[model samples]
Target: MNQRPKLRSPPPSSAASSPSPPTSPNLNRDKAKTIIKMPRKSYIKPTLVLASLLTIFALYTFLFYTPPNYNNNSSNLLNLVNKFDTNNSNVNKVKIYMYDLPRRFTYGVIESYAAARGGGQVEKDALLKYPGNQHSAEWYLFSDLNRPSESRINSAVTRVMDPEDADLLYVPFFSSLSLVVNPIRSANANGPADRPTYNDEQMQEALMEWLEEQVYWKRNNGWDHVFICQDPNALYKVIDRVKNGVLLVSDFGRLGRNQASLVKDVILPYSHRINTYNGDIGVENRKSLLFFMGNRYRKEGGKIRDLLFQVLEKEMDVIIKHGTQSRESRRAATQGMHTSKFCLHPAGDTPSACRLFDAIVSLCIPVIVSDYIELPFEDVINYKNIAVFMDTTTAVKPGYLVKSLRRVSTERILELQKELKKVKRYFEYEDPNGTVKEIWRQVSSKLPLIKLMTNRDGLIRLQNSPQSCYKISLYIENLDYQEPATTYFGEKPRPAKLACTIISMS
Candidate 1:
């Protein structure tokens, strides 16, 4: 190792007999006191200069160094409030208050059934293995809305804790989860001995009873309350009672005539089982003409699908496989749809199925064969641009479906596919326009009507209770220091006494 450099020392100072003229001891003492008493101001100036420089740097970073698109990425609460136009400030935000329902209604069902029924952790972990398998609608919605998002613009609503501050009351009950879990089998399927009790109905009954006890429910009788009944059969037993409430569902297939309308109830899209397809599999790479993989033996409206399958099974370039509800089936469906140009979306038990969204995700143009089908986000998206809709009679006619599909210009089909790709984000579970945001937007549209009904109900209540005594409390910040308050009115007011109290804040 190399030796270190040696250090040098300065010469010692010599003592001096008195730099200044000799003074009296008392005079020295007074001089020392005066020097010690002089104010120390040098350190403070540098400290203040440093503080000013730091403040200037901070201001520069905030006002100039920030990106021009800061608002797009900002999650600040003030930014959320400032996005709305000055004229529409009052109507921009809709405050929703969620009810504290029992676990059995939402997450309890997920924990109990989602893990076990979906194959424990193995199935959930493998969700990424296959590109197109999505969680159930109830799971998607419950998970998405549980957290707040910064990108939600048109539906920039807030969830409030206090019921009194709410524009709409949200019942966070996962109706589908409760129904799918602990499913009851039919007596006819298991021979007459197995009795079928309506579990979904019983749950709804208990839920209604619990809701009726709450003070918020008594206010407008649930007119401002919103319920999520995404599954067709969910809350079917108590449909009439909750009909007046804002009902959010995937479709109106399960509702009878006059049960649900577009004005009162919102149509939500089925959570696509597939992730978005961003591949370059244009019309050229898509060798298969049309594809449909579902149950060939379905009842009611699904019979049309069965007939089409029989007719198209032998057709060249058309893939029609018998469908089953299994992982293998889902994987096969995903692969088949990826290679096809047009995916067939026919009525099953209901006119709408998750298949349409799957096709959209796979960049396959959907050939919708349901005449009475209702699509989600129709107000925002024109379905005709992305899908080919056919009447039942026209589709069922001999060779009509294939002939009509063949008649579609290759360019037209490509256009539909491009449009399908554009709308795929809306149907995706993670997108801002997914279930939560769309549901909020739908609910926001109905707020004006809901407010009108609420005001009318209030007037009716007031009229019915003319003798009701109302007590108002006024808070004064500094009672003793402020001058006496004065009031002016054109008309005489009712005689009332005022009370005051003094309290120290500091």
Candidate 2:
């Protein structure tokens, strides 16, 4: 009886229970239907990306702002290394070159070098870094028979650069050999300070300035020696146009030399030399002084030589080189002049021009021959600083030169010595490296000087001597002081534009 009751209920299977639930409807049961699920994010991906970023960041943090690597082989990477390997071998550590004025030109070069023990202190103008003494210069650079640069002259002037290396090269313009300085910045072309752009114009102007120095080496009578017998108060323009004329003691020489051309440019018509301010002059000493300048003057084919043999006694304790002296003698002359208390500075044909830097090198006060002569750096440097200016017009006249000597006293001489000592404290040599470093900075930054790249046509490649060179002054303006960690040479002041004027010399 328990089993029989179940047979009646089996009648509805759906085919038996409910029409078999349509096949489609069964597929839509939702529970048994597979859901389109999104894949889970990969933990390895985000973790791996973060790990890679951290590793890179850490490595970068350690390497970049560290000390610049020195190629171990080149301890002094700045200067050239000789292949004593061969005497004729020519290899430059610094591709760029520099040239300085001859040692005979500046006594300060030797004194400064000797004092610094070879460039240990700082220079005022900062045009040079090394002691800039000639001996220190030659020791490491010109040690080999051939003279050369001490460091590469960087085109981009930024921070101070190292000394350049060289053996020798010709600088046709100045007609002398000089040194070159270039500092290679691993990151910046202009080390730390930005440099100005230079063009052919700048190069040409610089060359012109260098060329003007030829007036020094040229013989005094080169242009037939035009002398101006001028009145102290006379107009300067009156004699500006005198080309090839000689001025004699007679006033007629001044009146006739510039006829029609420079004849009447004077704002004032008269000349006088009676300054009441200057006090009494010693008669004997004045006469003696005039005799030293010129005992007799005679025109020899438009040239004049002082016939002062009787009075040309060597009183300066220095030697003189008259275009005919040995190299050693010439060097000695420079050193001698530097040691003297006063050096004669007979002005050239012109009245007040700027060629006095030469006189400064010797630490000797310039005993100027021209009253009209004015110094360029008159303020920063006092005439009283290192000079004994005399009026040439007054000295040239009757008994006037003698009177000038009377004005000078032992106290004045002592004062000159004090000033000379102060001057000696500073080193004044044409610092080729320092100047070029400045040039490099300018060229690297500005847009205009793109044309004048480092072309070594006139560069002198020489043997390298190991020595520290320049310490450049870095000028940073409006700099943010945050983190002083990252170094940067901001934009530099543009260099004065080079203006080229070609004067075809005949």
Candidate 3:
């Protein structure tokens, strides 16, 4: 009878309590077991998981990945692995190896030069905004190289990164990339500027209009040509002339310079407006303030760095002595130019050394050491309005600095302040600053809605054109060592031009 008491359906839908169907039997049975298991486990699962994730992150960052402070905008452009873990990113950043500076230097040099120049050590957040000039997607700047006693800026087109595409090797600095856009197709390729080359996206577009591949080089490998900064008359008087294409000048205002017809103009106005609209190619919102302070060194130019370091050490000592500086200073004392009033430049290097831009960003007086600066054609329009240039090569004296500093009085400083106020307007709203922006604004605006070098497809497309194929190959060549200028860029580059036809099917 007990074995036959199984498998019975006892309850009816509306019947009152015919049988509870053993519902309470299960509830009663689980209560005892639930009490025992509940005490066995703690409820810190979320907290423990969070803690584990944090520890893993910390371990990975310290041992495997490097985090960066985005304060320095230029740091973003540098191909620095330690600062930026770009090893896994999808962008092409320039990796600059500084071989221009002296070896075995002072600690303050990093601060005085990098920090004082940009006004800070560079917070990682600010860098995300800047990325870099239009040349590349990312930048990794380094200071570990065999610097020369007397440094030189050598720009060479060689294959360093892509073996397939050539790159530009800027000696004393690091490596660089080229973006192809509207080809500046030239019938004759004579001068270096006229040749198929690109500094930013805009210049790339301008070059595409006139495409010519004639690589000419008495072209020794190292720093072959110096961008001599001087009056237009002196510049045109000494050399051969190429009428077809444009010249690459330093100062944007040089485009605005009033030169005699007898005198050859240093830079073209179109050149200055080109870089203005190149997006990230414009000035940084936040930057490091680097102040290059030192005695004049035209004669011994050899110990310029030594003297600079000596001066910096003394200056830093004074600051720390008065508690203004510190022995524990991790960064340059660069808050002085917080809102754009800082800059640092090389005593002698290129016409517009890093200082010119540093001062431009800080909105400080550039304090030029050499008068021979042949600023690119139209640099002055904006450069002159911003930077401070002190001719150390000619007026070498502290009194000059004193007078110049004094001249930056409430009125002159106010003038600079007025101009500095327009910095954002110039960048976003468009000013005479953008070299490429203006051109795109001018010609490209009226044309079809086609992407320029700013678009990856547009850039890659340039690599396929029969003419641009080789030029692009040269422009992209940066695997290792230096690539010859003539082979990649091509020979017979007497007259410069651009290569803008789309050839790559992919």
Candidate 4:
């Protein structure tokens, strides 16, 4: 009864307070005016980006980071390899094409006098009377230039047998041997004696005529041809004819005023008796301070020697022997240079002599006293470190030569000797790969000038027989005609740049 009474009396506020069921937002139409949603992303995408960053970091570490022990390992490896390395450096080689000259031109000189004069034997005996051998370079060039070789340290050049394919035309004329084959006229001769009676003149004329008739010679006017004129007087008779050829000369002493120049000619070295000075005598053990032993009376350059001899004769440390080269003198020279620290290399009749090379082999620093002295391999060896260059005017001054030598410090002398030891190979011919390689390297440098001349005159192609043969011409044909050049060469065609033989395809 009380419940019924209460229900009846329940107010509107009590009815609103009664519990209600949950309503959807869409059910409230007036309140649901607008809605907004957020986009979703995958968790795998962010993980992939993190993996890529780590991979890049690993690569950077590998490239830029070096362990502290890396230098130690590198030095150890280099030391191990250096023992076997000859240290010749990278040899710059040029392709050489050798012409098969008639035997009379190249080998005939030695054959003619092999029995009576014994070719180089007489020359070697004569040189043993002095500090160095005179005709050694001629022998070396002739023996090793085009001779077949099985293996050699990066030689500076290669040889080709074909004339049409050569960068330089080498005439194998033994010009120096020809001069020595005949008896030498006395220096004081009056009439016909003044002129050489040697057959070198005849050989030279024959060679020039043969060369002029060759296709290569006519193309360049013999400008690119190589001639070995070691003796200044060896080829003087017909120098005018071959003046334009590449002259390999010992010195310009015999050349007329306007004929010889460094621009057109190469200075060759006198062959030294390498056996005497080949061993390493201690530089510190050298007893004498200054030494000179050679001819005193010379024509052009010996005037300075005479002056030095007179001035230094009385000096305590200076030992001067003014005499001709005799058996006793030659033995004395070997001993003198071996024991001395400084050797006086004043010019003789020429501006250069074999003494300088002997001094180099002896490891005795050279006191070069000449005004216009030209040196062999000047491009490769720096003579300043191993030699003292005092012009004739300065060296002729009394006491100057000794004074300058004395002023040089012991450390400096030892340093110069060390440098001298390094370059001894450059002046030696026993190793076929040594000095000849250097000569070929220098000659190779002149190829640019030769090419320039050839290109300027449009004579780059060989004007031989019937076909145009050159690297450029061959390339044009390969591109345009696709024709093989085997018919012309009669062998597998080499690259046009290296083509050395010409044959007729027709």
Candidate 5:
């Protein structure tokens, strides 16, 4: 519009030579395509590389990893599992096969004893009562196994009708009762010539004859068999013959070291004869400081009873009298123990007696004076927690035991009473999860050892080699108990020594 210097267009030839004005729209479109296509190609290569690395790493981990050793840690694991199963009532039980012996071996003994006592007839199936004595564990265990499976859901042993499914073979002979009911005879005495009937020796011989004929007994050489010989003299004639089997015994007094040991045998609690004290644990009702009411004279290891009585009978607040198993005596002994703070548990004919269990059920702290005593359920029970253990040497000293009792603080006494209450149920035979189940549990624990022994009996033959000596050291945790550790001396036939020690976790 500036007045129009009407300039003619430059020549078309000159415009064509200047590269056609740069083409701006087509250049921008080409740059956009390049950006999108380049990013797509770069992403594909990196994605493939990452996936390959992940696959290789997974394969390496799957082929090369190793777990840590668990052999030494098995005890802790087993304890955890046991705690869970105990609280859940899911304990694994032993499958028992009970032999169907004739009535003369089982309830017949009970019936004969009852008839002699002028009692009414005992119904075979309805027989639940046993003589009120310490050697009644056989009766209790037999009765428990005879019950229906549904009735014993929480029992530690189940009766299997078929022997093929059995973990143990139970010979339900009333050996202890038979011994008690029959007349005593010399070791060399034969049967009575007047009557062609059975005596204890004849009954024992008959049992062995019947047992030797059984298929299972011959199959395992009786190594997997179970016999309830709770009395020290229960099966005296047949003891050596049945020594390879599992013997449920009271103590090792009458048995040789080779005949029974903690390795292959189970120590059972004597059936308590006194009434159980159901009251709370406290000292307010207790009046006496020490109580003991048993035979003052005894034999062998039991000689210590006389020595202990000489030192304790004259002490103040003490009741130490000689009593036998009678109605009035049981009542008096029950009263004495229930009111006493501590009950004396000296050695009997054996290292143990029913008095110890009686004291346990009565909630009286046991003053154990037997040096070589082997206790029942020692693996699970810490005797130091519920009882006072004194060496036989010191216990017989004139002023030692009484002075020790006076030194125990009230707090310590209460603690002991509380522990006694907690464990008393284990000594009870009537409770569902009591002595019967506990005995079965202990037997079940011996299954592994039984199998080992059974297998070794067939494999190893020791020709004139001395019996292998076992010095078992039992470490009791969380206590101050200690005994001299005895080393294994394989030269002679020495009884296996159980050495205990305290191991503090703290």
Candidate 6:
């Protein structure tokens, strides 16, 4: 109570006593000065300012701007875009003029096969379908050429309707299929009078006859034409007739050095028969050390297959089977390749076969045994990285191949598997950038040489003389060409100047 009584109001300071009259003019003036001194509130926002500027600029552009005349500047625009756009550029494409051959040479062959196989009356679109065989490269190429231009925009070869604009001529004859479907007979063989059986020889003769009638074939003597004879015996009757053209082949095995050479021909990988392995590269799941499931007995360079079989059949951790190409056999082969560390790719009827591509797609390291083998796309693919090459002598030696494969470290096997996976797409025929495109690219690469040889056809004539015998030696080093043999010509030999080889006559 005493403390409360002691608490008294203190004297008011000047500010407290100066509670100025509310309506005073001086107070109002002071209030106005205080309000003016205070920092001004910013009504203008940065976002609003930017939006207003953009709107004005957009209006100005829409009112004043005009687009350039596309018709006048199209080529320049295309050049500029293509110069920058590497994906859709057609700079390296080869313009091809595919012959509109009679159906008897193309679809008729497939139709005959379908009838033979009990697949009656093939659909018009089903002409693209052919028997799944190593020789199907012809079918793939034909099918690719037949596709719409828009669909093949990125393809290495563009089908041009105008023959004058064509860089190369494509013969759409299904030579391989014709050989497979029709019976083999000598051209002079007799058949029933009522209905003469269509034979491979007759087909070959007919194809050559039709080809000879073509203006392009006559103009270039088939030097700029491309003929696919993948099978060893395909187009056998007319091999020499079409020798001047680019031969799409699996190998130079059955062909004579003069008929097909690496200089003028393109080697294509056989379409793989087995399912591709989709798993990552690893050794943990693979159980077998070596696997080979193909015909043990083969002819020519393929004789090594029998010898390798005799040696590898009894070896431990090896699965070598002499099996034909049945559905069950393919299944077995697929399983064997997928789980095997190394797949043996011994030569079959030819120096190379689909088995090598199968091994590649299966991600199985390939043990290539053919000495005379000329691989497809050798320019781009380094085979040594993904495959183990062995000469016939070394591979056939008992215990040599097995011992060598066993010596390969786990690290090395993994490396090979990785490389196989990387290159697997190149051998796949169905892939957009695979075998078909690569084959076209290979053909495109030969365009300059094809043009040069085509232009130089009748420019030079070498005559044989008794006084001075000129030896026209053309050597293709490291390829599977026969040794140079002397031929005493009664008259002048055809001009043998090739773009890829050095031809010298002395």
lDDT of candidate 5 at residue 488, scale 0 to 100? 38
lDDT of 2: 0.32
Candidate 1 minimal-lDDT segment of 10 residues: 497-506
Candidate 1's residue-wise lDDT over 175-246, tens digit each?
A: 876666553457665523332323556789988888889998887867798888888888888887777688
70-123, model 5: which lDDT tens digit per residue?
A: 884797898887666656543467788999998789988877666545466745
What's each prediction's TM-score? 0.68, 0.28, 0.30, 0.68, 0.72, 0.73
Off by over 4 Å in 5: 1-92, 118-128, 183-198, 460-506
Model 5 Cα shift for residue 131 (angstroms): 1.8
Candidate 5 clashes: the total is 0
| Model 1 spans > 4 angstroms off | 1-91, 114-135, 148-154, 183-198, 457-506
What lDDT tens digits, residue by residue, belong to model 2 across residues 325-444? 245644544544444444555543334311233344444455666544333222234666567665544434554433455467767766764665454322231244332233222223
Error of 2 at 259 (Å): 24
Per-model lDDT: 0.72, 0.32, 0.33, 0.70, 0.82, 0.82
| lDDT tens readout by residue for model 6, 75-96 | 8988677555455434667889
Compare candidates 2 and 6 on TM-score and give the better one.
Answer: 6
Tens-place lDDT per residue, model 4, 259-307, is: 6567666777777752447666365668899888888888866677778
lDDT of 6 at 457: 65
Candidate 2 wrong stretches, greater than 4 Å: 1-325, 328-340, 349-359, 371-376, 424-427, 430-506
User: Model 4: runs farther than 4 Å from truth?
Assistant: 1-93, 118-132, 149-153, 183-198, 256-258, 274-283, 457-506
Model 6 misplacement above 4 A: 1-92, 122-128, 182-196, 461-506
